[model samples]
Target: MTVYWFMMAWVILFGILAQVSARKVCVGEYLGEEVYESRVHLFVAVVTFAVIVFFAGARSYVADTTAYIKMFNDYPLFQNAHDVIFDSSAREPGFRLFSILIKTYISDNYTVWLSIIAVISGICVMVPLYKYSCNFGVSAFLFMASCQFTWMFNGMRQFLVAAIIFSCTGLILKNKTLLYIIIVCILSTIHKSAFILIPMYFVAQGEPWNKRTLLFIGCIVLAMLFTSKFTNLLTDVVEQTDYATSVEEFRNTDDGTSIIRILVESIPIILAFIYRNRIKGKLTPIVKLSINMSLIASGLYVISKIASSGILLGRLPIYFSMYNLILLPWLLRNIFDKKEKDLVYYIMIICYFFFFYYQMEIAWGGLEYASKILNVKY
Candidate 1:
């Protein structure tokens, strides 16, 4: 417990330092035009590297970390791409082929594979986020504090796919249809869920309060109210896919979405809606996408509440919810006046700190295994 709190403190301290460093570099710049200097980028890169290394090196701290290790250890070295792609497993071919290729040429060491994944995922997430966010420091901090960083430890494949999709934020924002489609198609080979975002790219770019937005929101609400029935209807179709086996048991489970997660994700959307007029004019394509995604995530949470198989469906929202890391900071910067921005920033820091605390301590078993990376145990 002591170690967990200490780790959290370090994360918060680094976040504060990132914000301060960004401010120093942008001191003379106009409001909302602060560019992240090369030094600031270096700081971000170093922090990201350190965090990824910690996660990659961790010893069974997260539940799926051990499972992934087992999978890598058990994976066979395929002779060719054809063999790997045609393997009898339900796992996506992209990652399957990647695993085979890595094991065939590189070391079969699971830690090495995990480290590689950590690097790719980190770069994919941070690069786009830095490009799109109004404040790099706050966005990075939210990425960690919101538990999205920690989530990568568990859903490695899904998060990797999501990160890749996130990297195309620029293409989507720029409305480069052909480019975005190509990217999403390539990424979908890693995880089929990436296909869902194909239509969402256009949906996200829509006006916030328009008919289309309201119609989608209403549909989401309707789905929530009849989640069990809706899930049952899809069970047959879902069962026919690779995901069918995985989602089979969840078909009848009554598990609901996490209220804490819902609250954390919804806060930015709520703020955006409240300050729509003030910030709407300032909404960049990236910001617009973030807001739309947040709404979709919130709606999914509501659906997750009533669906017997809600937990399975909940995974769909994560691709969007993660963007809150970028959205929250952008909204804060655009909506608040200079006088109130500091107060709001501090409040957000405190709130997100507790959110991280709850995630690591109360929710995820106190990060008890985190110290294992340092060969220390409580």
Candidate 2:
């Protein structure tokens, strides 16, 4: 506990230092691109690694880490990889195999493996953010500081996959058709819910909030809500199979986080909708893709929780995080003239951070409890 407090102070002190240095490089008149990029990347890498190590290491004391911790020691794969994956009926076969490989090959250190996963997710987010920032000469560091980037670091495996798939969506420069197919195929392996995003490529190309778009969103929500018989069908496939029921148990244990994220994370996205036309011209194809994904993800989140026992819609908000991190920077860049509105930008960011803090506390029980135990007084 003392170490936790010390670590928290250390992180704040160093974080401020990094932020100051980054701002100097980013907001300067003589902006040397190379210097700015390196400084920002180093700061992000350092802070990302520190946060993961701190929370994940103290997770038993600070967060409800039992679910993730279980994956580390469970070598269900090396012993029965094929039976665990193919003969089984769960949609998470890709994750199952990946977990097995981690258990088999990675150092027995659970924290190390989780850190690696976190780093991968963080880097995935950086790719889209970088591309979007490059498209319009905005500050990448400010973009990184968005709630989406930080919120995702705390989400376990589901967000990791979301980050990867969402980033891939943003990076579709040329050969978009091939990129779309490949990313969707990859994401489906992690969570079948990702399959829902495939058609969004076409949907994103259309105008926002159109009659057809709203109707389609309404239909998917209705389907998720009224389609429990289909979900039950999914469950039957599980019962008939011989894979461990353990994964099912893990998937079903919701802890009430997803529901909270759906309501909370959508606030910014809702704001985006209100300012749609203003941002429409400013937003690039990838940025537009992200916004569309966030909207569909928001709709999915409404009824997705019905199957939390087997699947969850709560994670859909992460699609918002992926899109909005870059989108917010673009929006802010457009709304406020850069030279004079830096303070306003900071204020907006501060308010958004408050939103993120409360959202994560309500959504993730581990974080909720940690805030309480640390007596941080909110």
Candidate 3:
């Protein structure tokens, strides 16, 4: 536990230091005015690894780790393998499949397999994010380092799917819709939630809308209403996995205010609407919508007691939070150019750390405490 804590502290320290030593990323690179720089990508990758290591290493194996352990323990699920073609399990079959392969290689050493898979998957995902951040600049970097990406630390398979989405957003935004769809389809095998972003990818590619895009919203609402019937499509993965029993017994535990969501979500939506032209300078309408939605969801969850456990609201915000991976660092870079740059930057970093720390405390209290215990300095 003490060693893990020191590792995390070192990661955070070295991550920020690496970022500070790098040059500012240029907008021209994103627009094809200039070529992408490997140096910027390298810097972001190093920092991303550090940040990811801090959170992941700080927390002893839990959620995702447990899932893999269960899969190995449930030998029949792997050997009998009834649904090998299409996994209707709670977790994406893709990730589980990887675990199964690992189980074959290290049949007698599940823990080692788990650690190895976790590290490799993390680096695979981080590389793409690092490249995208390099192409877009510091804004993307900061957003990735914040609470949003940190939360994903616990859900390995889902995190990989989400990371794939983030990695491809740069290409997706540049009109590679066909390729984006294919990539997301592949990610869907790991986590069904990845499909939610399929529509999001298209929505993100276009400009802001004056009217609420209720089509997909309506579809989601309808799906939620008829979740039991359509459970096959929306949540089949959960059914096949260890989560099957729990997910079936779950209810719409959320009774929070939609007003706050509407309000906070309005910030970015309105910004995209008002400055639809300029917001395009660094962000997309989907990014703005996603960020605002997360803020609203987080606020609502905080205010509501019942839905706190459902965590469905939290999921919405998590999806949106990825945009901040790039947005926050850019904001910090700007602050660094201001009068009290050093002071402001340090304050912001501390604030971000505490903000993320507390947000995790609220999101998964036990996990937060576990991380603190593992990362205990002394």
Identify the leading candidate in terms of TM-score.
1
Q: Per-residue CA lDDT of candidate 1, range 120-197, in tens?
A: 888888787656555666776777778777556777788888887887777776778998888778877787877878
lDDT of each: 0.71, 0.53, 0.49
State which candidate, 2 or 3, has the greater lDDT: 2
- Each candidate: RMSD to true structure? 3.5, 7.1, 6.7
lDDT of 3 by residue, 271-290 (tens): 33454454455543335444
Question: Which is the winner by TM-score between candidate 1 and candidate 2?
Answer: 1
Off by over 4 Å in 2: 1-50, 53-64, 76-82, 134-155, 170-175, 206-264, 302-311, 337-347, 360-378
TM-score of each: 0.87, 0.65, 0.65
Off by over 4 Å in 3: 1-8, 23-26, 29-44, 47-60, 76-91, 106-108, 134-145, 149-153, 208-310, 332-337, 340-347, 360-378
